[model samples]
Target: MPDECQPLHNINVGVLGHVDSGKTSLVAALSTKLSTAALDKHPQSKERGITLDLGFSSFTVPMPARLIAALPCRELQFTLVDCPGHASLIRTIIGGAQIIDMMLLVIDVTKGIQAQTAECLVVGEIATQHMVVVINKVDLLPAELRHKLVVKACKRLAQTFAATTFAGCPMVAVSAKPGGGDGPAPPAEGVPELIGELVKMVPAQPRLVRGPFLFSADHCFLVKGQGTVLTGTVLSGSAEVGGMVELPELRVVKKVKSMQVFRQPVSACRQGDRAGICVTQLDASTLERTLLCTPGSVPTFTSAIAAVEKVRFFSGTLPSKGRVHVSLGHCTLMAEVTYFGTPDGSGHEPAAALRLVLDRIGQLALNENVGEFDYSTDYAYQHELHGLEGRPSASGRQCQHYGPQWALLKFSQPVTAPKDALVIGSRFDTDVSKAACRLAFYGRLVALLRAEDPSELAHLRIFKLKMRAGSIDRVAPDGFSAVCKGMFKKDTDISLFAGMKVTTASGAVGTIEGSFGKSGKFKVAFPKGIVPAAPGHNSITLTFKRYIYDQNKRNMVQ
Candidate 1:
């Protein structure tokens, strides 16, 4: 059959469940390719009789001849990703979940829900909105008891996911393992029923053709003839043969030599389609799960400030100052959490605002003084006093610089993350005894702070002026000089001076910035100019940044 004539419906389905829950067995039954035999490819997995890594298999389920004539696609080709269920491999499961379109949650009918089963369900709920519950190994129970068990399992599932997005998903039962003492019994019960439920429940692939191309490579290897092959799903946009691609962090660009969708050669591939691409001018060894994007489409940043919400299953409160594992797509790294922002003034709420600073994990070398060059008027003389040999004749020499510290996090390496990206925060634990339930937190990247914008810090900063209400200040373009209403002793450190805020009787607000001089007078600068006030007549109030925890309100509920 020709390529166009063979209508293929490509969908990425992830098979997830607890250990020994027949996840691999279901994959084998569906594909008839014997995925368990491939488990021995890893010696440790073979010894333990468990899957230690992600297993891939594909199979085509033929559609009804009557339905095929009315649809654009003829067959459903599902690429099943069988993930490891061990507690130690939770990170691996997270990585797989990020790329899949829908999930097939397998559960052991005899055992119902186990420890890892609950963890995997939480992961799937966080990753995708579509899910199908598969209750496997029903052969262990009698036919009469099976219906009762199914009803009990459904109630338990509803209770577990009542607070989540996947509260009432569809459920089906099947026996993936071969039946005993049977000579080819006509396909154990619920086998065909499961397939029909899947066809009706699973949604069509999404089309993201306008935005820039974004692909996260989960696997990279060297093919015999092809130089480097990358296998992963397209997160957004589209890519075609001979198109230019770039790895923003690595700062390298390559050409797409060829493209394949589900092992079928194609001229182009769109969003939600699993693809394999062969690229030129790239060494296979240099690539390590890097994000591929169109040039100039993604922004690289060293630090960011965002808004985060904790997962419902996480029982404990997030630590103010500790390390947590942050996973964004396939990239997982350690991050520092800083609790910032004030709660509602109701005095009964806990802090809901937080800041996350990710640790750098790339290999890009940076200069020490990259962004340290001052752009002030006296920058030329200032650079000379520091024993600088060469200097640019111009004052603003386009060097990298860092701005004020207000809800800011700096990454040691360059990272590309757009606004509104889902950031999963998990407890960084290496102990095998601890369960996986303790490691699930979800947050959203709200905004990327730019160094050029100083006004961005205004909301997070607090100011308290030393001047009293009766002082009349002279305003100028450079700053305003005002006499201190309170007496200041000589030799007082300038650092003791606090920020100043003045509000006029007519309701005008302004902030003052500057240090105290030897004359006990202070000069303050305002971004929006100064508001005039009468001496000894205007009202002055001290301003400070309110801490969220100080409000004592409980805003977050588990």
Candidate 2:
């Protein structure tokens, strides 16, 4: 036999569904009943059908052989996560879904599939492929309708997810109601069969063969005895006790006090398994569901980016223009849409490239899949136009998908993560990148441009704007001279003597030439203005800072 039989221990399975979809009740019937004291609720979850946050509990599933020589393989320890089902808290659902090895998408047989079902399935397919769709509340379904709903649910799964890898998925019928004497008659004896299928279908956790470990936080909460604890599946590297973990955004590091996988304490946890890690030095409020990673191992990017490719925005009309919220991992920011489709205002759906000024940035990575915060109004607009809330028609707004395009996103704070993609969900068309060129453009970011080669940066162009720094000149004892080149003008040099003042049409005085540098032979200076001017040289060079601030203005007459 294959060594695949190494040791069957605990397999994490998360229950997902829409509100009132029976995820909690299903887990309740399967394991010992849950109590407010057992989970230590804050007077909200128990009364609310919407799981306030993440409800976690552990139980053993009878397996085939001895696992770890301690528990029987027939009995596998299952970490059941009952995630909140309300539409608004989908981020909470995503936080939990990314770490799960297998997902049990619970649906109400009476209600059939719902918007939440489609949403959860979309997230699940991105997070993991191993899924066993459970048609819950079968007990509530009339005998004549149960089978039909099961088939209908399967068809719905196939139709909604046809574009994804999980087109045709298997489903199990289960009732959370207790059996009078049979001790919870397997809601669907097929449930155990489905569990077996899960064992075979789900891929073993991927090994953390790299350096930077990516721990995507699914749940962050304060434990009664442990202070603050965060749980999630380590996406990439191995994390151990006594290991130091850094939060890129907060610029803080904490020691690992303990780590648990299946409620059993372990010294180290690897990729693929859901782990609950006890960390020190993090307050409950500060743990905003971000990653806990080893320093220098994960990808940390902070800089302005210049995306060479085109990108699209989807909110209102075809122009789809406006300020949208950008979310990656736990970070949220407002990014200016700039302009969509060719940047020149052509009606054609241009290649997927966009220029975004990241108004806010948190722990994020390059090539990471970022998404827009779908405001309730955005959904309401769809509901108003097409009567569809979550499923917006792509009629005229189909997102351009050219795979991952190069991008630059600037952040207000320093953010870190493994160099790998920091995905939010599986909306490929809605994601953007933080490429090397783009990062260097975001002002104040610590990340250096990969186009470190002066020639490379000089050639890196986004919408006809090339990356070029100005030549440095000691314009004065306390000031400096730098030049900026515009597409229409030759490189023009501007000299600032210490305390020398120059006023722009915007009425702001050029105070300090904060910094200066050169991309090729040209010099660049930071100035508080909106236009390019060489007062001396007829050809004017515009400072990038000035170039951006004045982009909306018409060129002045030399």
Number of the predicted model whose TM-score against the real structure is largest: 1
Best-matching candidate per lDDT:
1
Cα lDDT tens digits for candidate 2, 1-558: 213322234556778888878777667655543422224253676566357676666565555442324432334556667777776666666567555667888887778767666667655654565677777766665678868867776776656544434545676777765332325354433456555656555333324436666677756778777757887767767777888887665767788899876455777776655677887657877565678777755555543332222211123221222333434555545432222113333223233322222211111122233332111110001101110123313232233232222233434454454443433312223322311111111111212343324443332233323222222232333333433233122332323222333333334344324223442233333353234334543233233211222233332211
Q: Per-residue CA lDDT of candidate 1, range 1-558, in tens?
A: 224623665567888999988887777667633232233246887788889877766676775454454445767667788889988788778878767777899998788778788788877866666788998888888878878987887787766555445656788888887563315533545767777776775564334467899887766777777768787778778888889988776778889989776567888776666777888657878775767788777677655554343444555456544567776666677765553322221212222222232112110111111122111111000100011122212222231111111123334455676444556667757455655475545545555654334454333332211233424345564433333323334454433334546554454455544445675444444455445556655444433333222222222111
TM-score of each: 0.67, 0.57
Poorest 10 consecutive residues of model 1 by lDDT?
377-386
Local distance difference test, candidate 1: 0.59
